[model samples]
Target: MVGRLVIVTGGESGIGAACAQAFGAERARVAVYYHSDKDGADRTADAVVRAGGEAMTVQADVDDEASVDHAFTTVEQRWGVADVLVNSAGLNMSGVTVREMTLAQWQRLLDTDLTGAFLTSRRFLNGRGDRTGDAAILHISSIHAYAVRAGGADYCAAKGGLSNLVETLAIEEAPRGIRVNAIEPGMILTPMNAKAQEDPVYRRTLEQNIPMGRAGHASEVADLAVFLASDQARYITGARIVIDGGLSLMQALGA
Candidate 1:
């Protein structure tokens, strides 16, 4: 990945930050995009530099088209078109039953989790213009896309849609040499699972359901992102790789 340009949305924290640093370790120029955490973005960019890669932090509200465009413009002006795009900016399930969920609540999640991916992917492709050699788009979806939950209607629906989006984009862009794929993680120990990270007992309770008996780490996911972005995964596209320690496999157990 030496000299490759990469863009990681939500690079301010969690899996996104880890992915940025991982790419940086490969000597890639990383564009760290954050919606609200400028400080976190700065820290991520610094980590990239420390990892021996160039980086810049750009503010981008993925749900907003203008913001997405501006962010892409900034990256292009600073470092040229990105060779890799990681869409990791997303919100956790609202945990509200569909009956009680407000429209605003549902739309908020969809806007960021689904529409945001579309906007960023579009902007990234637009920046690519006609040159698409060795470019890849990675969407950080979730096992919930298929493993349904009682109070995750919004989140699940958005992710399910993202799966289709990735596949469709992969088919449409394959001729242009662009790859599109999704990373579906389950029970990851990111800030999204703050309760698990703060309380070991609670974390253990959840981990019991995972065949691997542990929650996944941001770095672990980042490693996978690095592999997917590398030439090692040149032939992989429209694939939904799961890094959840087999948690999704257990969802139907005891039923």
Candidate 2:
């Protein structure tokens, strides 16, 4: 990925930040996008530079089309068209049941998780304007896309839609040499799971359900993301790669 242009949304922290650093290590030019965390984004950009790559931070609200467009525009103006895009900006579930989930909550999640992906992907492809190359789009999805949870109706539904979006885009853009794929991650040691990281007892109880007896790390997912966006993963598109250390596998073990 040396000299390639890589854009990672939500790159301020967690999986997104890890991806930024990983790509930076590969010597790619990185544009770290953050919603409202400029300080975090700056730190991530520093990590990228320390990893032997050039980087800059851009402000972007994934849920807002104008904001997303402006972010991409800034990158395009600074560099050329993006060679790779990592959509990681998203909101966690509210843990509210369908009966209790407000319409506002549902819209908020969908806007950031699902519609955001759509807008960014569309803008990216349109920006290319028939210029075909070995570009890639990686959507940081979740296992909840298929695996249901008690109070995750908003989140699960959005991810489920994202899975299909990735597949459809993959097929549509395959001939253009643009790969679109989804990474459905399970429990990971990120801010999204702060309680797990803060309380060992709670984390242990959660890990017990995972066959691997542990939660995945952000860096681990970043490694997978780098591979998927590299020549090493050429011809591997339209796939949902899961990296949960067998957490999803135990769902029906005793059923």
The residue-by-residue lDDT of candidate 1 on 196-250, one tens digit each, is: 9999999899999999999999999999999998889999999999999999988
CA lDDT, candidate 1, residue 202: 93
Worst 10 residues of 2 by lDDT: 246-255
CA lDDT, every model vs. true structure: 0.95, 0.95
Runs with alpha carbons beyond 4 Å of true place in candidate 1: none
Find the 10 residues in a row with the least total lDDT in model 1: 246-255
Q: Candidate 2 on 50-151: residue-level lDDT in tens? A: 999999999999888899899989999999899999999999999999999999999999999999999999988987889887999999999999988989
